[model samples]
Target: MNLYWHRRDLRGTDNRGLARAVSVSEGPVAPVFVFDPTVLEHAAPVRVACLLEALEGLRAWYRERGSDLLVVRGEASDAIPRLAAEYEADAVVWADDYSGLARERDRAVTAALEDDGVACESVHDSIHHEPGSITPNEGAHYSVFSYFWKKWRDREKREPLEPPAADALADVAGDPLPSRSELGFDKPTATPQSVTQAAARERTTEFCSGPIYRYADNRDKPAVDGTSRLSVHLKWGTIGIRKVYAATQRAAERATTDDDRESVAAFQRQLAWREFYAHVLAFNPETVTENFSGYEHPIPWRNDPDELAAWKAGETGYPIVDAGMRQLQAEGWIHNRVRMLVASFLTKDLLIDWREGYDWFRRNLADHETANDVGGWQWAGSTGTDAQPYFRVFNPMKQGREYDPDADYIREYIPELEGVPADAIHDWHDLDPDRRAQLAPSYPAPIVDHGERREGAIAAFEQARGE
Candidate 1:
């Protein structure tokens, strides 16, 4: 008997590891999902809720196929081997997961299973190319994105494996799925609570069919929903990257104009960025907790409780920054452009450590990934590999005017700014104190002076580099 362990890859369709496990199984194949406490211990409420919904969907899927999903709650090393013993399983198969504590846990479980004489197998199902597969001609990993992307495009992608036939697992002992509360996690009350594989598919189809062509033109505007909105799905492996890549390729081929092709290409490049960061993480796992370039510098970060509270509550008095923070709190997600802006405001403007923002995002964002979140925060702080230049600072007011010229995004999240004129919306400080108070009575004053903070950030980076 063979066991297929579900981790991030929750869906049944087009699942690389699951399909492979079914294909090689000689007897009844059991599908298992472990509510590993080690992983869930740190998961935020929203992420916990989304994971429960996905597992519920997977349970129904296995049931309809006349098989069962065995859910174990404990340390994976104990749970997986215990389950394997129950089934007298010859081998255990699973999708390979990358870093964070999950990777370490997997390693420990694999070692334990191998020691117990159970064959353990892993398949790459997360990203298109394995981390070490693509490298420079000199046999070193490519640190630059464009060069990696060029090679990424040239490589032939593997055809997505078909979903296993129903006959693959006609009979197996099934287990019940657990609720978030059952696992000692609170249920999230957010817009993404209803997310499922079917919903994810619909979202993918809708974006690819219509909005994708104009993605490059409008992706920066948070007021407009121009993005794929599939990051959560991708992060959790609810959908396959190959499937999305194939769909994009097909759309590109059907394009009647060069502009359309370029749009598709641009979207595809973002996908490459996803993999690029993953590769970086694979090469240097320490990047999760330290500077990617090994730059060691002492930063005199403010641990001001009031400033941190203001930033988190979206009372920073900067409309763009506040909108991004509020949106993240309300929906457990934020736009890509705003993600950069807010991260910059936190790390650069407030002079807080990037780790603070990183940890917060890891707790809140439903689509959070270790590699992507770390890459983003460090890039904003200019301390990461292939990061933005240290001296370059993003002016929040300018970024708002450039991306959200009409103040539509600001109004959506910062309702107090609704009556403020578009011209003055980006610079509330210019208004007289009494008039500004009348317009946004509930909004707090800007927590930090941007001009001074910019200079401080530059000096801090220079000092760090010298160290």
Candidate 2:
């Protein structure tokens, strides 16, 4: 018998790891999922909530096929071996995870399985190409994304694998899943959307049907529901990467014009970006906490308790930045453009350390993937590969005016600005004290002067670079 261990890959459909387990098994394959405390040690309420939901969906999928996903809680090294012995499985297989902590746990689990004489394998099922597969002539991975995107775009991707046939699955019943409260987690503040295989397929079809054609044009406009809203699915692996890529390929074939084709390509480029960061994090795991690129001198970041508090509370007095933070609180998700904006507001404008932003995102974001979260925060702080240029500190006012032009997105999240005019909200910084008070007495004024802070942030980076 063979054991298929579930990690991030929750769905039964289009799962590479599960297919591999079925292919190698002489007898029926038994599926299992271990809630390793080592992994949960870093999880937040939002993440736990999504995990439980996905697990429930996966369990239902297995049960329908005359099998069950055995859900157990303990350190994987112990629980997996114990389950393997009990199930009498000779081999175990799972999908690979690239985070440093995940890798550490996998190493321990592999050693224990080996000691017990259980054959084990881990397949790269998350991203299209595994780490170190796409590389520059000199380095292990591309530091610049454009270079990586070129190769990733051209690579021949594998077709999505079918779910294991019912006869291939062992008819094993599993224990009841634990509730969030039983798992020692409070109900999440932000209510995330459903993360299930059905939901993933529905979203992909709905998005690729029409929205993708206008993606490049409307993606920057937060007011429009232009994005696929599939990040949570990808993060949880409710949908397979090949399934997503295949959907896009179908969308491309359905396109009627050059513009539509280019728009589809634009969205595909983002997929490439996701893999690029995974490759980077795989090679340099320390980049999760430290800067990917170093400077001659240390970056001089400020530490102001009140400012940090305001930023977290979504009261930063920057309409757009506050809107993004509040959106995160309300939804456990933020638009990609706003994510960069808020990160910039914290690191460059307030001059706080990027780690503060990273920590908060890791805790608050339901869709947070370690590689993407660290990459984004470091990029905003100008300490990552293809980091935002030091001289181009984001002007929150211009951003508000350009992206949220009518301030519709701002009003949707920040009710305090619901009555305020879009023009007044965008030009809040330029408005004098009396005008600001008259416009919105409840909402605070700009926390820091953007013009001054932008120059200060640039000077700090220049000093760090010894320029």
Candidate 3:
């Protein structure tokens, strides 16, 4: 018997590891998912809830095929071997994961299995291109995105594999599925709807049929539902990157004009950004906590608890920043443009460390991947590879007017501003004193003067650079 361990790759279809295992196993094959305590202890409630939903879906799918999924909770290194011994399984197969902790856990598990003479195999299933596969012609990794993406475009991606046959594993015993509350975590009564392979395919089809052609022009506007909204699905492996890549290529091929094709191409390039950050994380794990370039820039952060609380509570008095923060708190997601704006306000304008904002997002975002979260925060703080220059600060009011000209998004999140006119919405100070009091009685004034904060940030950056 062989065991196929599910981790990030939650779906059974187009799963490279499960496919390979089913092809090679002669005896009964069992699918398993281990809710490792090491991971669970740190996971946010929403993430834990989402994982449970995915696991339930997988279990139902497997039950229909006469096999069952074995769900367990323990250290994966010990759990895999113990489960193997119990089932007398000959080998274990799984998708290769790229996070530092995941890599270390896999190493320990593989070593223990090897010592016990149980064969363990890992297959690449998560990323479109394996890390370090598309390096520069000089055999070194490219630091910039354009060169790497150009090379990424030329490389051939392997066609997605089919789902494993159910008959391949007929005699395996399945364990009872556990609920979120059973694991000592409160199940969310109202959670974001889970994304399955079918759902993802529908979304991809819908996008390609219409919105994809307008993606380049519409993506930055938060008021419009322009983005793929598939980040969480991608993070959990409900949809394979290869599948997305192939669908996007097809869209580009069928596009009626060069501009439409270019839109699809641009959207595809964002996927490259996702992979590029993952590769960077694999090469420089320290970037998870520190700057990649080893620059020790001292930032003078404020210790104002009330100000921090205001920022967290979405009462920062900056319309754009407050809208983004509130959106994240309520929806477990924020638009990409708003993400940049809020991050810039927290780190650059408010003079708080980016790590604070990063941690806040990690606790709240349903789509939070460590690589993307860290990359985004550092990019906004001007401490990451190919980051925006430190001096290039975003003006919140101006950004609000540009991205959400009519203040629709702001009004949706910041109800206190509902009565404010569109022209004066971005600049709350423009309201007459009596009207401002009547419209937003409880709204706090802007926490920091933008001009002074901008100068402070610039001077701090100059000092750090030895100017």
Worst 10 residues of 1 by lDDT: 186-195
Structure candidate 3, residue pairs in collision: none
**Tens digit per residue, CA lDDT, model 2, 1-467:** 99999999999989999999999999999999988878887899999999999999999999999999998999999999999999889899999999999998899999999999999999999999999999999989999999999999999999998888999999999999988888888999999999988999999999999999999998898888999999999999999999999999999999999999999999999999899999999999999989999999999988688899999999988999999999999999999999999999999899999999999999999999999999999999999999998778999999999999999999999887878899999998899989988878888988889999999999998999999
Q: Each prediction's TM-score against the native?
A: 0.97, 0.99, 0.95
Worst 10 residues of 2 by lDDT: 33-42
TM-score of model number 1: 0.97
Per-residue lDDT over 1-467 for candidate 3, one digit per residue giving the tens place of the 0 to 100 score: 89999998878877888888887787868999998888777677777777777777777778888888898889999999999998888899999887788898999999999999999999888887878887877644666878888978778887867777778875566677677777777654225556566667788788877899999999999999898988888888887887878888888889999999999988988888888888888777777788765445566666467777888898888888998888887777899999999999888888787888888888778788988898899889888878878899999989999999999999998888877787777777455657667778877678787878988887877777777
lDDT of 2 at 266: 99
Each prediction's number of clashing residue pairs: 1, 0, 0
User: Which lDDT tens digits does candidate 1 get at residues 1-467?
Assistant: 88899999988887999988887788767889888877887788999888888888877888888887888888999999998998898889998877857678989899989988998889998899988899988744678888999989888887766777777864776556776778787766556735577877788888888788998897898889999998899988878888888888888888888888898888999998888898888877888888776556576676576777778888888889999999989899999999999988888888888888898888889998898999898888787868888788899999999999989998898888877887788877456778778777877667688999899888887887784
Candidate number with the higher TM-score (1 or 3): 1
Q: What clash pairs does model 1 have?
A: 68-174
Residue-level error in angstroms, candidate 1, position 102: 2.6
The candidate maximizing lDDT is 2
Q: Which of the two candidates, 1 or 3, achieves a greater lDDT against the reference? A: 1
RMSD of each: 1.6, 0.8, 1.8
